[model samples]
Target chain A: MRNLTDTELAARVAQDIPDGSYVNLGIGKPTHVSGYVPEGREVIYHAENGIIGVGPTPAEGEEDLELIDASKRYVTPAPGAAYFEHADSFAMMRGGHIDIAVLGAYQVAQNGDIANWATLDNTFPPAVGGAMDLVVGVPTILVMMRHINRDGSPKLLRECTYPLTGLGVVSRVYTDLAVLDITPAGFKLVELTAGNTLDEVQALTEAKIHT
Target chain B: MDKRLPDLASAVAPITDGSVIMIGGFGSSGIPFGLIDALLEQGARGLTVISNNAGAQETGIAKLLKEGRLAKVVCSYPRSPGSIWFERRYEAGEIELEVVPQGTLAERIRAAGAGIGGFLTPTGYGTLLAEGKETRVIDGRGYVMESPLHADFALLRAENGDKWGNLNYHATARNFNPVMACAARHSIAEVRHLSDEPIDPERVVTPGIFVHSVVEYGVRP
Candidate 1:
């Protein structure tokens, strides 16, 4: 079966975002989605630090220390960008002003609960930054991540073992193997990667997947 | 009346040991580095710092942590990629950390500044962060009661300011500075430009009433 590359997964996720949508792209793999947004779509990116209308990453030597995204990566402002304080930024988030939020996940349950912020391990300190706010505030939560863990264990599960960022908040998930939607019935398989069969994908998923 | 201070030492002189202080910034932006240096030079201990993140390694707040002056830190993002100082101290139990949700932390500080009592937020309701907090269901959604977070001193950086203390912040550098200016009992601003004349009223993001003193720092072009 052909597995999608990280950039390919990002492009697939970008294809689903509608034009002129105000979106927040979470740190890590989700940030890559901003670069793959289709041409002429005009998606306004929102950074939790205090910017709406975030633009593309700046070229080398053109980076500004003051203009940075939540990831602390240098970013240029799009035309008509606006800035505010931290409280106002989150108010825009929690008030449902953001149409969509794209995030990276460790596991997603059939019930749509997302676990991304923390693991059960004691070595890594768990830090729940803005994921809690974004998951609860944004109307549509889209998760982009690897379909399985490093040991080849399925991450799409009946219930997440890791601490959840939000309960039943995820609407859709895009992985290297397939695109799935969370429904009242369970995981509804949208499309699988080329050369992959339903049975093969289902074998890796713990939850009941409807093709 | 003019509220300008002649130097950074006098601006941060009021911060005594065991004081709760808010230092404005997101990562490295909008941080009052000059004032923080002054505080380090002053060598006060047992400080409780409120901020969005523990500053990067060997700079700003991390330096203070290295100096063993910080007793506790109340922030949303305590772990950054280069935050070795915080990580080392945290694991060793040398310092205390209260990790708040980013939005909740911002709102709590705003609540303190606005003179409002505790408020309800849905961000941390079902998460581990919500543990032991008051929870209420409003319109079928659960919310946790979060109290206001006030500090004794607020040290912030501004892009511009006038003698009257009206301030302007540049780009994303405006993150926590304005709100923190109001939440503290004494707000000291380290500004790039200290003008003899008052800043344009319409351009002021932080009104002078909230600010106690302003010190001119970095060069302005």
Candidate 2:
């Protein structure tokens, strides 16, 4: 079975985003989705740090010191970009002005609970940045992550062991192996990466996969 | 009246030990570095800082944290990758931390400025962050009660300011500065340019009424 690369997975996620959608790309792997947005599709990126129309990363030596995203990575402003205070930015999120929010996840339950901010161990102090707000506020929550943990354990589970970022908030998930939707019944398989079978993918997912 | 101060030291001189201060910025964008340096030189101790992150390592609030001057920090996302100073201090119990959801933090400050008592937010309703907070269900959704957050002093950075203290910010650097200016009793702005004439009223992101003093840093001839 073929496992999709990070970029490939990002491209797949990009395909699902409709044109002229206002989207927020969560930090980490989800940040890569902005670059793979299909041509001619004008997706307005929102950064929680008060930028609504976020543009692509600037070339070397062209980076501005102040124009940065929530990830602290420098970004350029898109045409017609608007900057406001943090309160206004989160208002856009919590007020349901954002059409979609793409985030990275540690685990996803069959009921659509997402656990991404903190783990069981206290290796690093639990920091819930803006995930909770995004999960609850954005109209659609799309998670981008790997199919399994480093220990080869399934990430699509009956219940998440870690702390949940939101309950029943995730609508769809894009992973390295396949695209799945969180339906009222359970996990519904949308499509698999090339060379992968339903049984193989199902073996890695603890939740019941409805093909 | 004109609120422009002569220099940074006098601008931050009113801040004494044990002051609850809000330093405007998200990470490093709108951080008042010059005022931070002045505060370090002032050597005030037992400060309660309110911000988004605990600054970066060896700079801004991190330097103050390393000096063991800050008694408490009320913020979200204090554990940035480079925030080792806060990590060691927090683990060792050297400093106190009150973590609020980022949106809740901003709204609390906004509430303080707007003179609102408190509001219900769904951000931390079901998490450990919501522990000990009052919870209410409205329309079948749970929300936690969050109170307003006020400060004794607010140190912020602005792109330009007039002698009247009207201010403008550069792009995303405007984060938290405007709201913080209103939430604090004394709002001090470190501005790149200080003009003799009042800034255009329409372009002023922070009106002069919210500011107490202004320190010009990068004024060009």
Candidate 3:
């Protein structure tokens, strides 16, 4: 009965992130969550290269030269931060130690199949980085992205035509317009953008939505 | 003269003038500002450096650019000519620039670490980039051949590391460090925290065997 705004949607996603959770915020928009995490709550941020306990982006003059995130963006060090060889960071991801992996996706199938790495177009060749490892290793997968493509195509579909990063790995979808829970029954609309109607939202999505 | 490799640096010693080094970072992210500071403090001059991108003025690998310490550079881009001391030297015919495609640069470093002599890829074909490079056809696809590249020394950053030199990289800092470590004759790592033994071996990103030196100072701008 209640709708959420974009900022509210971000807060909802942030609210679900428990304290002390080790999270990998995928590149692009997912990186924005770092600034949204409620202050005073401790969350350990892991970059693929090897830094952890990352705080939000530093102010212009306050950045530490040695500290940065997987995106190569400058960051501050959280208390008790440690650094090590890079293989160990991937090992943590591969060994299923990371609790949450927040990623961006091009398409999410009804069965939670995620296709984020590549497109069908050969002209736009894709880069398959550590994303394959993340989907397989991270226990919880949270996808943060825009609800639709620039051409106004719905990214959430009954099936993904694009190459999949992993099958049935997405646990939740955080979009600009709504929050969704990918379930066995199909995509369940958990929350909608404020002032937007279910009919309007469903019209925008190609996938069937269950209230 | 002994041909065998010697022991690691016992303590923090100043980097000498005219040293060749490889910096680990993508763009400005993992540029090893602390090491740059150490280099600046040492006032090393006439250095040869390799990296992905020269950090913009006052950032990343660009600190060396600001210091005008480099005698030569090999990278993808030249953002700050004024800050890059070597660029002026290059114009004056006193420096060298070995430009490379971003992907090829990474692959070259990787090939060096993997012990491969050379590799062929389509990343740069039929361009000035292919000049003087070997070309081959694999499965009817043409690829420009490139040789493996190794460094005299490599500087890297990691998230958390154990005493054994096992490393975990923060997100973007994972850029060039892993590959550079493998290609370098000697590897020195800068980490935020150091763990005692009994570190979960599964969590190790880089093995201690590859690491010859450790700098425990956390990343400070």
- Candidate 3 local lDDT, B173-221, one digit each (tens): 6667877878887777777666655347787777777766666656433
Cα lDDT tens digits, model 1, A1-211, are 6789999999999999999999999988888898888888889999998899999889999988888999989999999899999989999999899999999999999999999878897556567788899999999999999999999998999999998889999999999999999999989999999889999889889998997
Clashes of each: 0, 0, 38
lDDT of 2 by residue, B1-221 (tens): 88999999999899999999999999788899999999999889999999999978798999999999999999888889799899989888888888778898999999999999999999877877788999999999999899999999999999999988899999888999999999999999999888998899999999999999999987310
TM-score of chain A of 1: 0.97
Taking all chains together, each candidate's TM-score versus the true structure is: 0.97, 0.96, 0.58
* Tens-digit per-residue lDDT, A26-106, candidate 2: 988898898888998999999999899999889999888888999999999999899999999999998899999999999
Best by DockQ: 1
What are the candidates' individual DockQ scores?
0.63, 0.59, 0.07
Predictions in order: lDDT: 0.91, 0.91, 0.70
Q: Single out the weakest 10-residue window by summed lDDT for candidate 2 chain A.
A: A121-130
Name the regions of candidate 3 deviating beyond 4 angstroms. Answer: A1-6, B1-23, B31-221
TM-score of chain B for predicted candidate 3: 0.84
What clash pairs does model 1 have?
none
C-alpha RMSD between model 2 and the true structure: 1.8
Candidate 1 residue spans exceeding 4 A from truth? B219-221
